[model samples]
Target: MRQWETAYEKWKNDEGLDAHLKQELDAMHDQPEALEDAFYRDLAFGTGGMRGVLGPGTNRMNIYTIRKAVNGLAHYLKNHCVNVNDRGVAVSYDSRHMSKEFAVETAKVLGAHGVKAYVFNTLHPTPLLSFAVRYLGAAAGVMITASHNPPEYNGFKVYNEDGGQVTPDEAAAITEAIQKTEDELSVPYLEQEEIEAKELLTWGGQEVDNAYLEQLESITKLDADEQEQTKDLQIVFTPLHGTACDLVQRGLDNLHFHQVDVVEEQAVPDPEFSTVDSPNPEEHQAFTMAMELGKQTNADILIGTDPDADRLGAAVKNDTGDYAVLTGNQLGALMLDYILRHTDPKLLPNARMIKTIVTSELGRRIADSYGVQTMDTLTGFKYIGEKIRQFDATGEAFIFGYEESYGYLISDVVRDKDAVQSAIFACEMAYYWKKQGKTLYDALQSLYETYGYYVEDMISLKLTGKQGSEKIARIMQAARTESFTDIGGVDVLAVEDYWTSERMVAGSSQPEEIDLPQENVVKFLLKDDCWICLRPSGTEPKLKCYVSVRGDSEEDSRKRLTKLKTAMDHFLHRTQS
Candidate 1:
């Protein structure tokens, strides 16, 4: 019998399994392919923690997996944390299926080990969980969410005491601790009554909400006069049936923005996310309801946040007088430009901005124009948060950090990508430009005119199941070994293999070491300073290809991007086959 078959049988024969999981197992007895997919291997847990579809399998997100992960976190904390008994874990959840259940179970698991659990009384956004860790002085934090993933998906993200996602070393240690559990189903947990009696579980949210709002308020660079002048700027906001309606509304109110309109259809907390195909703001389809409302209300701008409110997306009237969603890269440049232009001159000398390797370089150019240094980290926002902590220690100012996937961090108080703060800031920026008689889209055009036109796009190809995982590995290997002189008629200048942390130029036989951390990524530098990068998604079963090109005009940039995308897609398809 195969390994997966053996594991399937082991799970099938266990009479002590949870009732719902047992029912699911019995229903899938005759479905060999489904069984294999579920039992092929354990759901991966790494720096991003564990994320998977919700079901009854080793590779699924269930109560057993959540327990096992929390159990391991508890073990790792005991060994590494100081005063673990007193400094408990802070827990929060989004409006996903079983999110509350998972969070409550996480607290119970920690309570079973005599550690306290400070959990939010109700669902909150992911960034607030990051803030609660430091606000409550907890040892660590757990956010029960899948961010912007589909309704069937869920995740568990771990955070360090410093309010950022756990570092790679700490994550590895936690993974090691998790691997020692022989049986996930047998992990012990305290009941709600038992935990409460022992003072192991504490529920709070309003205080944290107020405190977080205060911090958000303090980060506004605009003075009272400017804020008062911009407060009436018409705006429409949507939370995509997730956990940002209350806080974002309250936040805008604090900013004295009285003309804000909320998309009532998507403001309620919904586990199914019924209105859209997916809750992600990266896709334009997610803004359908918001756009309609924007048209009816004649709003100046439209903003939407994903389920957990960690990513923000916006739509502005284009040259055609229709709502057009701005790409993450374009929004990043806008925020960076507005922030740098408004920040105190004395602070600019010590200020720094960070972006992922795959993000557009237009922000870098803008930062350079302002004399602010720009740093690039690997593809995760955790690295950006880690840099913020480092800069805090070294006395450097972290002005802003963003990813091309619509995640942005405006203030370091909330270590993760905060959509709440970014949403308000984006509105402020829109108003700032409006005062100058320009729309946000108009501002983007002006930016392109000042700096060169830069266009970027990401192609995500979903390759799922065990076979797909193998194919992704093979594709990465092929990218490293294959020789290419040019792509889309452009000469290849260099090849950067992030896995080896080395760059090989066209003429240099010697490879230069990269200053960033090693990751499973490769970049092909092309002529005219354009590039293409390939990396597998850390939290999902997909391979992402990012292409960036510069041009003298918008048409030129779009044409270059199209050619590069066509070539890269062909390469990926050929490799997969």
Candidate 2:
């Protein structure tokens, strides 16, 4: 029998299988493809914790897989954490299907190991979990969420004591511990009654929320009167049937911004996410209801948060009097510009902003104008969060951190993307611009005028199942070996292979070393201040291609973007063929 077949057989005969999962297994008995897919391999725990389609096999996300992952985490914590039983772990969940179940399961596994767990009583944003880890002085934290993935998907993310996602070294240690557990089926968990009797579980509620919101409020750069003056700035917000409805509205109200409207159709917590195809705010389709509401209210801005409320997206009225959703890069630049302008000049010397390599150069330009140094990290926000912790230890300043995927961090209080804080700050930015008799669109244009006109875009090709994974590997390998001197009529100035940690300049015979963690990524630097980057996504089954260009005008920039995108699409897809 094949490896997957043997794994399937083992699972099929297990009497302790979950009833729902058992039924699913029974249904797959005659379906060879389904069986193989489910049992092909254990669900991968990569940049994000293990996430997969919910089903019956080891490779799927069921109670058993959740138990195994938590079991491994418990063992790793026991080894690394001193007095871990008292330090405990913070647990929180979003509104995804089985999210609450996963959170409970995490606590049970911890309880069995005599480790305490401070779990939120209700669904909360991912950033709050980050905050709770530090506020409670826990050894670690787990947030049960899949962020912006589709409704059928759900996963958990691990955070270290510093309230950021676990570092790469930590993840490897945890993975090693997990591999030592030979039998996931028999991993133990404490009963709810036993956990309660042992004082292993404590519920977090309004008090934690108050503490988080209090810190989140500090992200507002404006003073009291300026905050109050934002009342006239009409705003529309939609949580997209996720967790941000109550807290975001309350936060805005606390800022004295009364002209805010919530999209009633999407304000409630929904697991199915019935209103939208996918809950990711990065897509314009996710903002449909909010846009309609903006039109009805003639609102100045539209803001949205995904299921976990860690990523935020915003749209402002353009010159055409229509809502134009700002790309993550554009919004980040706008926010950075506004913050730097208002920042104390004395702090500017010590301040530093961070962004991913794939993010727009406009941010670097804006930071340069303010004398704030900029740092680039790998794609994951964990790297950015790790830097924040390092800066804190070294007594350096971290002003902001963002990525191209609609993720931003303002105050270091919450180490993750922090959509809740970003939403409030975005509103304040719009209000600030409005007070000057300008729209956010105008502010964006002014930024372009000051900086060069930059156009940035991303293309993601979804590849699913085992074959898809293999094909993605082939594409990445092809990129490393393929030779190219020009693309889209632009001469290639350089090539950066992060996997090799080398930069091969056009004329230099020797490759220069890059001082960053090794990852499977490559970048092509073209003439005319244009570039293209390629990498496989850490959280999902997609190969992402990022293209950026700066030109003399908007039209010129867009034309260059189109040509580059066309070239890249052909180059990436031809590998599979």
lDDT string for model 2 (1-577, tens) is: 9999988988889988888888989988899988998998888887566778878888888778888989999999988978899999999999999999999999999999999999999999998899888888999999999888887788978999999999888898988888887777899999888898889998876888899888877778888666655478899999999998888888898898889999998998999999999998999999999998899999999999999999999999999999999999999999999899989999998998999999999999999999999999989899999999999678779999999889999999888898998999999899889989999999999999989999999889999888888989998888889998988887899999999999999988999999888999999999988999999988788999999999989999999999999998998889965
TM per candidate comes to 0.99, 0.99
- For candidate 2, the TM-score is 0.99
Model 1 misplacement above 4 A? 228-230
Clashing pairs in 2: none
Error of 2 at 383 (Å): 0.5
lDDT of 1 by residue, 362-460 (tens): 999999999999999999999999999998679999999999999999989999999999998999888878879999999999899999999999889
lDDT of 2 at 164: 95
- Candidate lDDT (C-alpha), each: 0.93, 0.90
